[model samples]
Target: MSGLADQGMLDLGPESLEYRMIGPRPDQAPTLVMLHEGLGCVGMWGDFPDRLAAATGCGVFVYSRKGYGKSSKATLPRPLHYMHDEARESLPRLLDAIGFQRGILVGHSDGASIAAIYAGSHQDHRVRGLVLIAPHFICEDVTAESIAQAHDAYDNGDLRARLQKYHADVDNAFRGWADVWLGNDFRQWDISEELAYIRVPILIVQGEDDQYGTVRQIEIAQEECYCPVDVALLPGVKHNPAREAPEVTLRHVSDFVTRILQGHEAAASAA
Candidate 1:
């Protein structure tokens, strides 16, 4: 709930991205970066990152991409290349400015997709790995239906009011995200081709009952990626696995990263 420091800013020339950094453990490996969902902000993560940092003893960076949370609002209609722009341009700049050499990305929903794109694309191999929760690849009928329902809930239901507690500029956040998703040009939004370039180890987590996306999304990602990828489908869970199944999510992430870290040590010993 702290301001300014709890929510920091990253300069991106004309645009400044909003972010929060916690868990300054100096000795930890592969700093954990928490990437929020499409309509999420630091507040919206709801202490999950903090709890995760404590559990893993790693540095944590939680940030809202431009036009969301307390970050700079988009002045023009977001181009169809929004996610691509974030992954190819803005995310690298943010990490460079923050001086993160290597880190494990943990992202949910849209954030997860963006993280995957970045890890898959980075030439320097700075992204050690990824933990994706309910990520999207290609736009699907199920995604469209869920977004339509979200638009309705935002306009008529109490979703707007509920979302306000998490975002400072709630209207801007909701409208910016909703307008783009429902826009005609966005119907073809897909990242499958972009994701094919990813070669780092990945952990994909999804809910059996997720209303927002189909299992095919994760399945496609696992099948297409040219790297080690693991999938977990939580039973009876909804879209937000971090909230609905925190311990389960944490354990999966912790164990996967632990195994990777151990593998790194074993390789070092062999060498």
Candidate 2:
């Protein structure tokens, strides 16, 4: 495992990843390995990571996966199970390489789905809990419709220009995510079974009026997960909770992490 102070590009075999680390390292404190949305990169997270680190006193490791941000370009026409591929393959390497000890997998949107897959697919006791913001467990009709609209926006609106600021190759970042989800085959995409296998607790924060998905996503997690499930359905909020309701998101995430990991720290010290 590499040192937490390690900066610049992360070596992940054929493709290196761009990353930013904040606050204490893993050895000093529990870490929060943040996974961005399908179209998001390390830059898009902005100052949220900084606030989270200050609030929780934990390190925050944010990175852009392949095909997004400044990272290497992904091959075109990505496989239907691209999220699965990332969960089982790339994510594990990232955690081990960074010397991740104990912490939660904090994810937003697609990042949340990937986190669910990784936790359920393995028995990693180090992953103490999960903080999922706008996670999708199954593909909904609304999801497809919203993605179709996004295609139009990307082509015609200022969305492309806005995205270009954060992504090195905007089309690759957008198309890699948009194409797979828009495919007819993706309609049947579901990862609910993975939830049942997750042994750690979970905290799901979703927008009540999310255009991309409905509360059914939350229902799936509630129905399938055996671990303790906490839900925060924010009223008048949209897909991106952190952006739309930063303070609320910060409070929920920081409190949950403190309750889980900080409490654990106290108990361990007592023992």
Candidate 3:
């Protein structure tokens, strides 16, 4: 954990994203690229990345997206295509800059959706698998309701104060995500089509009691994706699986990562 926290920041020209590297060297094994949630940042992830690294013996790289954490402030009123732009533009650049050759994307919430978009859109062979935590394939009524509740909590409750600990501009982080989701135009926002093109194996982790999304999200992935898909529905958990059910989530993710790495190694050796 100490070593993981000691990692430095990455300057991606226009926006300097803060990042931490954990576990083994990038050259020694496959990497786990973690993408935080909408209102999440590098610091917000806490020791989950460290625990994951320890469990899998894989290098883990966690980064805060633009306008979050120590990254540069984002332009006001983010477009409807902000997530798409991240998948199509910023993510690729970040991967290249880090020299990511072989890896799995471990993403949560908004970050999970971005990972799905990237896997479907890009035929990058380096990406061997995906670990989607609390992913949303399409906009749902519950999503809007929960976000609206969050908006109120941010305004009148302690949610903003808690989030401020992680985000440099807490308002930007929360509003950018909440505004887009709560907007009428966002009702049509769906990435199910993206699932059809993803060639790698996938592992979906969802809390049965999640307020932000439902089992429909996982069902859509099962129905659309051609690749093998695994699921873990935790009973007493909510939106944040990594936080609420760390041990179980860690075991599932670590097993999936190990299997993929082992398979890749076997294939390479045979060739």
Candidate 4:
């Protein structure tokens, strides 16, 4: 598969972030901004963004946060509120830099939390909706355990070798995310209250067997958010729905994007 046709690094003063844009005439459609997993980077997303663009007829924008992928190296011991920082600070700048007029945030794992935070905190009208895959509204024991297992995998398994292919500073990428999640202070990290403030439609997709978080995360969004919420719990899938269940994930996301765009068009016409 061909890589993103338009790709580059953006200098955001203190740090530089790598980004990729996809789809035919990206400016024409609503942009789907993809936020990768905790240890993920632009390269790790592979062809998923392209697939999403093809399926939804929407522009796809993906970027690597500082310290991941080919982006600038980050300082060690990431703050407990790193996701918060991304949502509150970095995301807005990136969107402005990209000239994003219409957008839907599609985030996975750690990325999902950032998306939810951005939606709730910024309340940016340009962001029409959200697609959260295996998001963590509140920290859980399972999440900590899963991070511990990941640490073990990086130490004793082939996980590091695999991840090295995508990250420039592999240790920074792993330790940066692991250190924060495993920290005692991070246990209380919760974004449930933030969800209540999100006004746009949201789609929550999680695997039934996901080891990191349970359906409670979804329940929190459903219970808290006043806006419409759609969910899909894949029977045999795991945390990475895009990879674990591509077809199903694509169909649901594409359909959701279409509906959102259609509604936007209808509203414009009504006005």
Candidate 5:
């Protein structure tokens, strides 16, 4: 693979993150910047980014955060406000580094929260929309319990071995996510306020049977986001909707992207 369909390390001074570009580069077309789940890395996304790019005819950019995949190790005992800092500090640098011209922020789980915060905090006109999959806007009992179970699995079961295939530092990747959500300080971790300030449209794709979060998450987006908030709650599905049910998830995301981009194009022509 060469040209736009290549993988490389992106240097951001403090960190050198791993990333993949699918289909067109950001300069050539609208882009889809995918943010992975809590225990997810660029590699864990598998070929979903490729499928998305093919379906939408947009550039797809996916990257591992500092601690996940082959990226740099995270600072030990990650700060309680790590997600906030990521949205406010790290994400902006990444967008600027990539020369993100116009695109939708496609995020899953923890990635979805960061995308919400970024969209709310920055009025970057280049960001046209958001496609949030299995996003959690607020803490819940189910979330804590699920995370605790995940930790147990990692320690006592084959979960660690499974994750090792993707992360260079598996412990760092799991610890950074597990410690935060399972920590007492995370109980009130809510980004509902951030959703309110988002200026663009949002498509919240969730699973009805998601083990990590509840329907309240979707409700939170509906209540807090002032902009148009579309939803797709898939029956008999789980937390990882895109991977668990690619056909449905991809259709929702692609249609959302197409609709929003077309609207933006029309608006631009009129302006």
Candidate 6:
């Protein structure tokens, strides 16, 4: 049942935020929730989720936000509170709607920020662990510069077409992210405060060659998290660590999730 799609709706104010689910074993084992990047969707994730799920024997849950993939397109402009709202309001609603009480979150870029915010804010929830691939904790000059380059590549280069292979509506997904980040208001966006509240173990991964973020971003996350934070820098890897170094990423993810769960079980037994 690879790539099988399902629909889920979460109530966010007066509007119903729709999401699309992909991959098999959505409810099986140590369920791994795959959150896409700012310009990503279920299709954009390619076969990574399926392969990871198979390798780890974990149920994989993937969902496209209101504006991306087969889910409902966003009509309103993205506000400064968008990411915060997603982490605080939309995520919990979606999880509760789907009955996901506990699971590991695999997040990238914007999705990674959302994961950090959620893990920090929801003190009572059961987030077994987190795997942050190319996550960011704060706004930096380097991030803005890379995003500017990405804008040029998207408009002047063939990057948009290359991305079309992964997105059904590539332009919508691409511009939605680009415009939001490059906007005047978005320059103030930062999530470091949210990271301080997270008490769960986290695996922060980044590629040394990643143009969008620097080592400082991962280091900030390590400092903020209340629990153990394992940092891995993949050599010769870029912003898309999972795509560029699947084997290495998979091994780390599998080992981290298993060890965390085992440690929890041991503590429970002792108690």
lDDT of each: 0.79, 0.93, 0.91, 0.91, 0.92, 0.77
Residue 132 CA displacement from its true place in model 2, Å: 0.6
Provide TM-scores for the models.
0.92, 0.97, 0.97, 0.96, 0.97, 0.88
lDDT of 2 by residue, 128-167 (tens): 9999999999999999999999999999999999999999
Model 5 C-alpha lDDT per residue in residues 1-271, reported as the tens digit of each score:
1243478888889998999998888888998999999999998998899999999999999999999999999996888778888899889999888888899999999999999999999999999999999998999999999999999999999999999999999999999999988989899888899988999999999999999999999899989888999999999999998888999899999999999999999989999
- CA shift at 196, candidate 1, in angstroms? 2.2
List clash counts for every candidate, in order. 1, 0, 0, 0, 0, 0
lDDT of candidate 4 over 1-271, digit per residue (tens):
1233588897778889998888743356689999999999998888889999998888899999999999999899899999999999999988887778887999999999999999999869999999999999998999999999999999999999999999999999999999999999998898898998999999999999999999999999999999999999999998899998999999999999999988998999999
Q: Candidate 4: where is the Cα deviation over 4 Å? A: 1-5, 24-26
Candidate 1 C-alpha lDDT tens digits along 179-208: 787788777887787667886788999999
Root-mean-square deviation of candidate 4: 2.5
Please, what are the lDDT tens digits per residue for candidate 6 over residues 1-271?
Answer: 2323464554555445445454444444456888888888777777788777777666677887767765666655677667778888878776766657556899999999899888888984568888999997776778888888888999999998888776656777777777777787777887888888888889988999888889999878766767888988999999998888988888888888778877877887999
- Model 4, total clashes: 0
Model 1 scores what on Cα lDDT?
0.79
What's the CA error at residue 193 for candidate 6, in Å?
0.8
**lDDT tens readout by residue for model 3, 1-271:** 2223446778778778889888775666778999999899888888999999998888899999988998888887889888888999999998888878798999999999999999999999999999999998899999999999999999999999999988888898888888989999999999999999999999999999999999999999999999999999999999999999999999999999999989999999999
**Which pairs, if any, clash in model 2?**
none
What's every prediction's RMSD, in angstroms? Answer: 2.9, 1.1, 2.2, 2.5, 1.7, 3.2
Supply candidate 5's per-residue lDDT for 156: 100
Which ten-residue region of model 1 has the weakest summed lDDT? 1-10
